[model samples]
Target: MKKILKYTLASLIAISLANCTSDFEDINTDPNGISNESLTQMNNHIGGSFTPMFLNVFNVTPAWNFQLQQNLLGDVYSGYMTPPTPFAGNVNNMTYSLVDGWNGFPWSDAYGSVMPFALDIKNAVALGGDASGEKFVHLANIIRVTAMHRVSDIYGPIRYTKFDDFETTGEYDSQSEAYQAFFTELGTAIDELKAFEDDAQFAPFDMSSLGGDIAMWRKFANSLRLRLAMRVVKVDPALASAEGEKSLSSDAGFLEATDMYINTGFAHPLTVISGSWGDVRMGAEMESILEGFDDGRKEVYFNPAEDPALAGAYKGIRMGIEIEAKGQYGAHSSIGSVVDSETMQWMSAAEVYFLRAEAALRGWSNAGTAQEHYENGVRASFGQHGVSGVDAYLADNVSTPNDFVDALNATNDIAYPSDVTIAYNTSGTNEEQLEQIITQKWIAMFPDGQEAWSEFRRTGYPRIFPVVVNNSGGTIDTDVQIRRINFVENEVNTNGDNVAIAVGYLNGPDNGGTRLWWDIDGSNF
Candidate 1:
């Protein structure tokens, strides 16, 4: 047996010497110049890098506030990934009312690019196998859950069961069922990643640092689970606590909210025109909220409006109110555009803290104090956007912490308190606490678009008034509002049956105003 193994090794080495390069020449193909190692390995690495890059593009942070949606300032932010401001301007799709048609395509992107590549990395590692397999699955599942959570949030009960088979027909799956998949996947991922003992498993996968790459990735997975538990607090409170408890239960465990983020220190290049935030501006509604509170982040986030230093003149649109016809509001943005390439963000520490804060307030017992987790989220949000002296802000009036409403109005209040603390009154009902949870969830969303939209749809807390001028060729019913987007044009022509089945579940003729399954909460009364 020993002799056989030695000869087998010799055979491979001899082959390498005899004809390392294939003789076949199809002028287009390179035999000698491109090594087999390069062909195989580079393809996988390039594919891996490409997935994160493309994801950085679509994670737009949708909000009813100026910090989020203006063409210029908002675009430059890590909070949201927005489209190029069009010539006449706006997301070019005619179906732009409910969402930019692009944000609506996670199904194709996740299954096709994001999720599959992540799985590919794992497969490659397993076949011949690299130690990186663990991180590959961990990170992939983080992103996969991120995209899937949005799919379930946006469209309601999306088609999860027909995942690989959506090729035949895009069958619509139930929201509860889809969430169960997220539950199983997240739980398994956290367990698998936490169990991985090697530090080198994610060296190449590190977007941040080298030493603890896999550890950070493990935290990201756990943090993502924390976030999912919060998102469905409305749909399933029992499950929410169960998941959170599971994390605390893991002894050999992961990073908690206070230390759970991977800060993506993306720097700006020489050119703004091609940069990430260059074309996007802080949306008026978002800007107004920050400015109204004298929220320090306003300046860090937005350049003073080109013509006016007065906050009211900047991207100061009202939230959730119907805009008058297009003529009523200025389509032109007052702040400068977003420098696109300048920012990159990832699942953050503050986000996890905020999730835990909400969970704690609802009495989901856990590792950290609810109040501490809440303040950590606020502090992280402030620091990320360059807001200074945040520690001082929280310390100014330490006895009484500012609740979510206080923070929301901090920039807008006439009598804005100079000294406010991050405190919660347990006397506030669970209903009231839930509102506070979501409202800050709105503010902490400076750089994430999909989560903001998802939170808003589920909680409807930071409500936006209707669009004054929408030409989406669909009705904006006062009762139902946005239901779902009309199926993408190509899909209707190609996967008509699945689209038809989804429409049937919708009850409301299947357009943007249709209410999805989980979004069917609360009495509009």
Candidate 2:
């Protein structure tokens, strides 16, 4: 990684631009006499790249609990969608946050960090450098995609090609274009990695330091390809389906074990319990999910809601009522339980397996029997997570659904510690097996991204609940949940015309309640 040169260049720019603008100088200069060593410069840059990956961990906590967590719990986000909004609002609450319809406040750790360093890494590869060069390009590409998705998914447009240029203001590409670019970027990187084809090894880069090793980098790249493909399911099925299939068919590896995942080992302050984000309780939906499936992972996902103050007066928030009145409606529901302790979930291989299962089920190229992929996904999840014995799981009612309808319904069912997977129960129909597969997949990714929500939306397999008790939103959801977030406030100001076009086409009349391109139909697209 050639870093000192970039800083020197920036400093030179700062010296020249000081007369024109103090702000430019501020961005380009430090004045602090920090060590000017090349290794130090590289470390500074790498440390900065950590945000895309770290912030992603935060984005999903709210989403996992908000989008996937509560939906599985009982179909409510903190209830920003409902009449009397929950204290923690939906899509609106995330600072400068939007799902897919608007603009966002843009920051550029990835631009300054991941992008330049990656360019260096790519250049090194081109020069026939060692495994470290290949590793850097592969991991940097994965990191780049991660950051791009977060920005593009939220704001609907971003600067991809000219992103890192300090001199240029940068052009905003449409979300469709950005998604396509990501597919190209990651796919090309994958090919380059294979082209490098190095057997030599070196000291592994810290997941905290960079991303990981060459093999892990390949797995991470493939896994990300799966995620990005899934993202466009509503917008471009043909493309999304093809991307999904390629990962499944290709020997590109995925994170299947806990150890194999991009484990950050992030310090406690960043954990769900104590991080700046606050201890994310196991959202009520997640709790319900665990209870419904009779899944044992609840123990791993959360601790019992502790009102441990022996002198308690209900000071602690009730488990599932974070967003008060709004949760009464469908799609306006419970979230993951907030635990007393802090926790951090980087990534998991089980996630990759489940993602693969989805690709296979959709009948992608080189995809295997859905049944086999689904089962392997289940076993791999169980095996990686440390749950044991299929015997106890088979006996459970909710977790082991007897038929397809029963299994789909089981997703909304509160999972219990005793609930286990018993796919061996051949007595059940094939669809029933899919229910078990998706339901478990939902459970596996509890603390990570919104796969469960996407799976539920796409498959509609694990039947969940409607907001039957109270009509908070008052909209009356007939079939299933709403898709996509309303774009953030800034879009109207910064990119008004383009934002309007997307909202008009994508959101329809009721913008917030609208669906994205992939979520064509709720009954499992």
| Model 1 poorest 10 in a row by lDDT | 400-409
Q: Per-residue lDDT tens digits of candidate 1, residues 1-525?
A: 223333543454345323422222221154335445644454355345434533433422232122222222223211222222332344233213444434334554444445444444444333333343455555565666666666566556565555433242256666677777887887787677665646553454454432345555656667777777766766677887788777655543444433332323433321232233334444544543454444676554445533333344434432222332333333323333222343444455666777777767766666566667767777887765667867665544233212222112233222222222234434666655555555555666655555666666666655433333354565645433443445555445655666676667664665666666656468311
Give per-model CA RMSD: 10.3, 9.3
lDDT score of residue 195 within candidate 1: 59
Please give the TM-score that candidate 2 achieves against the real structure.
Answer: 0.64
- TM-scores of the candidates are 0.69, 0.64
Residue 304 in candidate 2, Cα distance off native in Å: 2.6
Candidate 2's error at 257, in angstroms? 3.6
How many Å off is the CA of 130 in candidate 1?
A: 7.4
